[model samples]
Target: MTKKIFASIVTICGISVMAVMLLITALLNGKTADSAAGHVRNESRLIASAVEKGGSDYLYHTDFDKDMRVTWIDSGGKVRFDSHKDADSLENHADREEVAAALKTGEGSSSRYSETIMKKTVNYAVRLSDGSVIRVSGVHSSFTAQLLKLINPILLILAAAALFSALAASMVSRNIVKPINDIDLEHPDAQKSYKELAPLLEKLRTQNSKVSRQMDEIQSRREQFSLMTESMTEGLIIADPKLMVLACNTAALKLLGAGDFHKGQSIYSLNNSDIFRRCLLNALGGRRSECILRTGGGQREVIASPANSIDMVCGLVVFIMDVTEKQELETMRREFTSNVSHELKTPLTTIYGTADMLASGMVQSDDVAQFGENIRGEAERLINLINDIISLSKLDEDSAPRENENVELFALAEEILDRLKLSAEEKNITVSLTGENVSMPGSRTILSEVLYNLCDNAIKYNVSGGRLDVKIAHAPQRAIITVADTGIGIPKQHIGRIFERFYRVDKSRSRKIKGTGLGLSIVKHGIMYHNGTVRVDSEADKGTVFTIELPIEKKNNEQGEII
Candidate 1:
């Protein structure tokens, strides 16, 4: 700024001085021309007086110098005599401007230039007393030649002016800028260095105060927003129209698996999914878009919504939510509906068929009891399936707080084993109970269901005369329950899926066994409600063992007794 200011001032000063110099030169040129013409007039008077006193012969005998030429012309436009040339051979002077002017005006003067000699001539013609004209001409150098003669001196003067201008401009520029440079921006009104700048400085001081306040407010809001988002589970992202990330929370980075993220980096680089990037770009194009991006073994809902201002999309705010549980629940609902429909349809069909036969008298007297039995049996199966579904629905809600009652684990196992003994006898399977007598804290109903499902499944899947065992024990921190059956065990591939609703290892075998597929699924959910884990060990044609572990809660630290 300093250099530019100095240079501009110097340039302006130099140009002003040069302009004045040029004007003066033009004025001098005009004055010189006028003086030259006046000098010719003065010299012409002498020659004219001499001509009036002497005849044409007296003018022809006088010597004329190389700078001056003398001509005498008669009133009839004939050249009567010349001073430097032969008078008889000279052209007529009647067509000359000065000769014609003198004849009309008595005295006239004019200027002309000779191209061959490159010089200007000034002529003064005065009319003689005999109706003749006497002309005296003088030659001078051209204007361009005069300027060439003065070039060195003019350049020397301009150089000296330039040096002075540089010094003066520098001093003036510094004075003009000194007040501004010395201004105390933090406290503008503290000192009055320059009166002219007082108003400007005060205004700056006021604006600075306002700007500082506004900046503080903006910074406060930013910090508040960051604090609020830091601990949020949902991912939040703010990006620009170019899909560059502007702000992203920790959750957003972790959600998108953005390992190394930075501001101004493209959001498309956050993930490998083409569709997700497309959604982000679409949001930038003034549209809201959503996509389910599977990440980290779970589903995430990526919603890209345009942030609009005055009906135009300025940027994007993407919200990512962990929707894994929601999506899983939806899938489970769909599967449950389908399974219920099919499971209910089969038993209802059987019941309807048998009842219809009986109502129409299709069964004879001997077969009537058997048909009635079939209808009752199908109805019972349908009832059990409905109960299992109701239990699963309750578990799915997870809203039911269990009873705060302690349950005797061994006693509950024994009771469940007793209830299943009759069924085990029908299959000729030996049922036995083993392990230590232990207890846990839980709802009695839920604990009963857990034992009954395990023992029932053991009996249901056991081979003819196969052995079934229920074991109960206590670990240092938990209670353990084991149900093992020597039966057609689960296939290794299907073992993991056995707890899913309606998942059968062998459909045909399950049909002959006449068991609801929800029994084990119910057991799994019910045990989980009590904070337990269940694992299975099985091999086809070998045997299967189901083991459960539930955290133990002792009523008294010293007593270690049940409540």
Candidate 2:
């Protein structure tokens, strides 16, 4: 608006200056024309006075022509003399305005009038010595009118020039302002063109850029706010001042189990629960509140807070959170604590009972020794169970042992078979190790422990005369080790839970065999910490094959070799 006003003022000032200049020029032209005409009339009167004073001499001595009429009239209205014809034949001229004025005043005068031979005349009348009139009139043409006629064309040309100049000025001004009109003030190019504009244009551009930058900053802040809201993990919803749904997030959509929540959907429509509606109403009323809502699948706990200082479009932002899994885990933790206490108490009671009997010396010396050994064995079993529990806890923590070192799987498997060979021999189970030497980049102690546990379990659970095989092979990027035993194979239902701590296929059979039920769990976590996987294939009453694949050290191209 201000720019338009300034442009109008500039245009008006330009036209006003041109008009004032033209008016002064026209006035000067008129004054010059009037002065020239007056000078021409004075010169004509001086020539007339000279001729009248020397009339007889001019008529006799000078070569006066017959076509020229030279007459002298007296103040009494008589033609005193005529050069061309009889004096009486001429009309009286003393009564003429110029003649009478010259006779009375004795001064020369000029007048313009019509004559018989000419349409216009320039008459200069002068008084003679006897008070007669001598009038000299020139009838060449309308000289003053002719000069003025020439002025019209010049005036027309000047007017046309002025018109063209005004048009050109307008077009030039528009052309200069055109680029400025299209210039984006927020852009760098607008600032680059600052040196080209006039002072006013430069000022305008500076103001425009400031306003544009301010608007851009506001927009950037708005975008940042939007990103924060959208990227939030917790679900968010916004509503108008009237408490109508306006916007929601992906988490909200999943929580609602609906794809579309159009505008005007009530808070109750989202959950159809009184608790949610009441919470929303309380938030809308400027009271912050938190409510837990149970849906068909799970529970959602939402905290609603009133928004302060809304924009022109008033709205409120609501935050929501899901705590169902956390609640479930809390409940499971409490139950697990009770179950673990019960599980440990039975074994501790058995060990305590055997120790008490041996201390009391209730049996023969040999029997008492045997009872003491039984108590010792039971105590050892309890210690093993506690140690396994501790190991499983360490695995759950996912911590790497400090004893990690490069281990040779082939050597580790051979050592494990050597240690378990006696046990295998007692059952008539043949234990064999088959593979080329292969090395893995991990802890030797942990890897050896894993092999020992697998082999021990295979020998302990195997039927009489069964075969146990340990095979080690070099895979593409890992060392593959398999421990197969013809044991009482695991049932399908129990296979999935075999790696879980304290989980057993048959509780009674596992106890009878003195199994701590933590062997597979330890092996699984040990392999996992080494960036390996443990896979088991088993069938009831047949056998079980446990495969451990651990990554092998590779060259720059990640190609491993068999040692």
Candidate 3:
């Protein structure tokens, strides 16, 4: 701004100076031209007097004028004599313009000018008593020649004038602009300005006060808006009708996989998804639109709603809500219900069939015992499945706190192994116990259930003459229980779902295994109830290992209650 002011001042000053110079030059040139023409008129009148008295003899006797040309024309319109050239060689002067004008007007003067180079030639003529005409002419370079001759000096003068003008303009501009630049913006009222600016400064002071108040209010609102946006979990974005981003929260930025962006940039710079584009277009068209967007961050439901004012769409307010966890919970609930129904109905159906046969006396005496055994087996399976289901429900609900007790983990494992030794014998597998008698504080029932399930699975899946190993060890602050068996291990793809209720690794061998598929799931929930962690290691046709870890003491049992 300062440079612009200074340059404008210098330009105006330069133009003014050049105009004055040109005007003075023009006046001087006009005066000089008039003065020269007057001198030539006087000289011509004296020459005419001499030619009139001396007749034809005067032209031959008089000395030639060196600076000008004079010619004597005969009355027959031919040049009879000339001072500057041979008389016979010259063209007829009676036909000349000056001569023709003189013959008609008695005396005549004419001047011809060339503006291109600023040159002029003046001619004066008189009619003598004879039929011939007396003419006098002067030739000199135009004013432009004089100007060109003085061009170097004139340019020097102009350069000096421009320099002086520029310096003056610079100083003047400083005087004009200093007060404004020196104003203390933080305390605008303290400005010391000129009298002419008093009204402006007073108005400025009033306006400054209003502006300050407006800024404070805007800042306060901005802070409140920022707090509201940051406090929310759902993502929010505001956009103009052109789909240019006006504002967005941090959640929206993260959801769209975007970094810091400025306002008024097209939203396509953030996401070029066709569905998102359609939603934006629809919303801007005054129609609310929604889309499910999936990205690396998970699924989000994007809703675009138009903001309306005065019966017209003004902008769009988009809300992006994360629904990944909610969707997964819904799906799990559905699967759990279906699996529970199927698992319970299978056992109940078997028991009902057997009991119905027995009550009708359809079975012979010899087969009655087998039928009763079959009913009893199905009944036990049903009861065990029901118990497992109840325990799982309690864990999920985080119900009443269970009594915590200190139990020797190695002794508990040994007892469980002793009970499972017969099953191990039937499978022709060797059972062994290794590691220290690590004691941990937990619910005895849940911990024992966890250990028994692992050991039972190990024995059940063991190959003929395979080995079962139960290890209880102590870590820095944890009790580690590992039950490993050399058996047909789980497939890698099914390892992730092995702890899901009723999930079986091999459906064809499931019936031969002779146990509910809910065993591993029960192990998971029981161990989870005691504030412990469990991990599995397995290989196909090799073996499976279930490693359970319990804290030596309850470490911020955030799980709330143990069922």
> Per-candidate TM vs. native?
0.71, 0.54, 0.61
> Judged by lDDT, which candidate is best?
1
Candidate achieving higher TM-score, 1 or 2: 1
- For model 3, residues 382-405, the per-residue Cα lDDT tens digits are 888888788777776767367678
Point out where model 2 deviates above 4 Å: 1-215, 229-234, 238-247, 255-257, 262-339, 359-364, 402-404, 554-563
Q: After superposition, how far is residue 232 of candidate 2 from its true place, in Å?
A: 4.4
Considering lDDT, where higher is better, how would the candidates rank from best to worst?
1, 3, 2
Cα shift from native, residue 307, model 1 (Å) = 2.3
Best by TM-score: 1
Q: Which residue pairs clash within candidate 1? A: none
- Locate the minimum summed-lDDT window of 10 residues in model 3: 554-563
Worst lDDT 10-window in candidate 2: 554-563
**lDDT (tens digit, per residue) of candidate 2 on 82-132:** 656698887877667767787888755554545443334445566767766
- Model 3 residue runs over 4 Å out of place are 1-191, 194-203, 206-210, 213-217, 220-233, 258-262, 277-290, 308-310, 359-361, 400-402, 418-422, 558-563
User: Candidate 3: lDDT over CA atoms?
Assistant: 0.81
